[model samples]
Every structure is written in C-alpha cells, then in structure tokens.
Target: MAELQGFVFPRTATGRSSILPAPPWHYSGDLLTIEYRTDPERVIELLPDPIEPADDPGAVALVWADWQSCSDTFDELLDPVRAQYKEVFFVVRGRYQGEHVSRCVYIWVDKDYALVRGHYQGYPKKLGSIHLTRPVAYGKAGPRLEPGGRFGATLAAYDRRLAEARFTITGTADQGGFVNSHAMLHTRFLPAIEGAQAPPSLHELVTMKTVDVDAGPVYVGDADLTLFDVPGEEFGRLAPREMIGAYYRQVGATFVGGTTVHSYDD
Candidate 1:
C-alpha cells in the first residue's frame, strides 16, 4: 500500500493547519446584488485606518449568492452537499493603500466549512441562514419589468431577520466584467495562544485580495432593500439612501493565496 497524502485529520488532535487544503479554491454561482448610496460619514467611521469609503457617493453593494465551491482537485466535485452553500455580504467601495478597492463590511454563510475557510482567508464570516431566490420567468418581458419577476435574498441569525434584498432584471450588458473587477480587501486576525509568555499573541490586522476572477453574463436591474433591527448586524448601520443599480450574474473565480498589505500590531 502506498502512503496517502493530503488526507483529512481530526481537528481535536491537530490544529486547523494540519489538514489545510491546497490553494486555488474554485467557485461557481449565481449572484444577485444591489448597489445603493449611504451616508459617507457613517461608512467612514466603520472603516479601519488607511481604508477610506469611496468619495463618489458612499456606494455599498449588498449581495446574496448561492454557490458550489470545491478545491482545485476534481474528486472533490463529486460531493455536492459539501460544496453547496449560500452567502450574503455587504461591501463598501473604498480606498486601500491609496488604491480604489471594495472592502467587506459584513458577511455571513450557512456552512461550517465555508465559515472556517473564509475566516482563514480573512473574510469575517459568521454562521447564519441565507436564503436566495432566482427569478422564475425568462425571455422578453423578462423579470425586470414584470411585477412578480424579482430575485430576492434574506439574511437571518438567531431567529432574527437581519436584512432583505429584492431585484428585478431590467437589462443586460457586456459591462459585467467591469462591474466585477474591483479587488476585495479583508482583515485577518489570529489571537495569541493563552499562557504563552514569550511572544505576544497574533493581534495584527492584515489585508487579503482575490485573484483570477472570471465573471459571466451580468444582468442589470433595479432593486429595493429593507434592513431590520438585528442587534449585532452591521449592515443596519448604513441605512440605504437610494438605489444605484442591481445585477444578476454568474461568476467563476480562483481564490489563490493572498498578499498581506498592512499590519496593525507591529
């Protein structure tokens, strides 16, 4: 018998790094997103130093996505249940290291594996219930202009509704690539182990970016948003000002290794 490499290990016996999956996680999914304006001052207050909210209009994009993700290896694709999951996140157009970028304010997922993997990549992901709905109607008189053809998504946690987004496809354009080109920045933090006196815990705040993005068929539309009073929900702070635009599309991307841009503590 030959030795098997890259096999899963028990987390209790070995730390998360013991069974780390190889790089270039691949994902394909339908994304329904809404761009809206919000108060710039509030948005700025929420951002970390060196990351400023966009000066254009404090634009915030909220997305609800249903995705099937797997490692680069083909064998992993056979397990659909382990690969499928739902996500809802809010991102603000911001400036990072003097460059325009999109920074995630809050994000949630329904899968434990995703939660762990996302956190490792600096995505501030929490466990929650995310429900995404696709438009059932197609062709002319497509979902955009029809009264009941809207795509929607809802986020809830601890039995409390956090937010909801509804969008109707109005048109299609080749600009999907442009709209999805923004680089995403997230913070990664690992606390120091307790009772370790020598080197203090890892308290540094780091930034990570996504690469090799391939966006598919972007549909433009109008959307309406409703935010609820969830105690810990950060999305409630922005308070939608006006609808900028809405979109529905499919995207495939490889989330390879990330580069650390800034460090907060030493």
Candidate 2:
C-alpha cells in the first residue's frame, strides 16, 4: 500500500493541506472604498523610521471587498465556500525609501485561509465580522449599480462596531485611490518564541505588486464615515476629520511574489 500526503504543505497530514495552496492566487472581487483625511500625527504613530509620512500624510482609504479566490489547483470549483470570503483593510499614505507609497496598517478578513496567506505575504490580517451591502441586479428591490445607488459597510470585532461608512454613487471614473495607487508596503514580523523576542525569526518590510491587474469602471460617490472607540483598540485614533469621497469598483489581480526592502534580522 502507498501513503498519501499533500504536495507542498501540511507535511504531517494524510491528504490535501487544509491551509492555502501554492500561488499565484487569483482573485476577482467587488469593492467599496471610503477615502478620508485624518491627522498627520495619527499616521506617524503607526509607521517606523525611514518610512516617513507622505506629502498628504493624513490621507487614508478604507476598503470593503467581497472576493472569490482560487489557487493553481482546485476541485473544478465544485466547492464554492472554500473560495469565497470578505475583507476590510485600512491603508495610509506614506513614503518608503523616497518614493510615494501606500502601507496597509490594519486588515480584517473572515477566513483562516485568507488570513494565513496574507501573513505569508506580509499583510497584518486578523479575523473579524465584515459586512458589506452588495448590490443585486436580479430584482428591483436591492441596491443597484446605477445613479443614486446607495451602499453601506461595517467592521466589528470583540462584539463591538469598529468602523462604519455609507456611499451613494453619482458618476464613473477610471481608477481608485490608495488601494490601487502604488506598491503596497508591509511589515512581515514573525516573533521568536523564546528569549526577549528582540530579533524576530523573520522581520521584513515587503512590497506587493500583483500581476494581471484589472480595474473595472469606478463609480464615484459622496460618503460619510464614523469610527467608534472600542475598548483596548486604537482604531478610533485615526478618525476621519474630513471625508474625501467614496467609490465602488470591481477589481482583479493575482498575487505571486513580494519584494523585501529591508530585513531586520541582522
């Protein structure tokens, strides 16, 4: 008799790895974005040295997305739940190594596979309840992607509402803000289990540029944002002082590789 095992991961498992498969992972999704302005000091507090605030440091973008993702290998899409998930992420404007950049400071996803994949790619992803009002075109009841279309989204953790926003579409554009503006920089830190944990087992500042990028017709809108102060959480500190605008769009990309600008293990 022959033994069975996963090809790349879960060396001890008898079958396919419950974790994510090998990349490049493909993603197709609809997203709602809320762009806002906070304060420079708030943005500064989240960043490390050498990666300073941008010219408009307070500019931030929050996104709520519904995604269907698959790896290079899957069971012919027969299992849909394994490929569906929702995520909300927060991004801020910054300059990395003298170039304008966007850095993801916080992200919350609803699936373990998505979280684990993000960790490997340097995104600080955690689990949360993310609810987005997806537009439906079947009947004339739910929101539609036409003029005056209204949609809302929320993020909650520890049974507390952390963020909220509403958007009403007015027109169309060709692009999105920080979420699609530049190469996203991330801090990949895997702390050591023993000793002061000063030097992590792996500490890196990596950049992400997904291939096969496609931006759908962007719907522009006016937006309102409200952030709540949750106990033991600092998400409220970056509260929006002014609403920039709102947008809804469909975006597609493939994640394969990341470039590390700095490695702190030395």
TM-score against native, each model: 0.82, 0.92
Question: What is the C-alpha local distance difference test score of candidate 1?
Answer: 0.73
Put down candidate 1 lDDT per residue, 68-129, tens digits, no spaces: 88877754579777788999888876777677777777889999878878777778899999
Backbone clash total for model 2 is: 0
lDDT of 2: 0.83
lDDT of 2 by residue, 1-266 (tens): 55646534454346566476767888999999888888879988998766888988888888899998988675525688889899998888788878988888889999888898889887889899998888898986668888899888999987988888888889897766664478888888877888564667888888875899887888998888888887877767788898787899988899887788888755
- Which regions of candidate 1 are displaced past 4 Å? 1-20, 135-148, 176-180, 194-200, 203-212
**TM-score of candidate 2 against the unseen true structure:** 0.92
Query: Which residue runs does candidate 2 get wrong by more than 4 Å?
Result: 1-9, 13-15, 74-76
Instruction: Give the clashing pairs for model 2.
Output: none
Q: What is the C-alpha RMSD of each candidate to the true structure, in Å?
A: 4.5, 2.5
Best by lDDT: 2
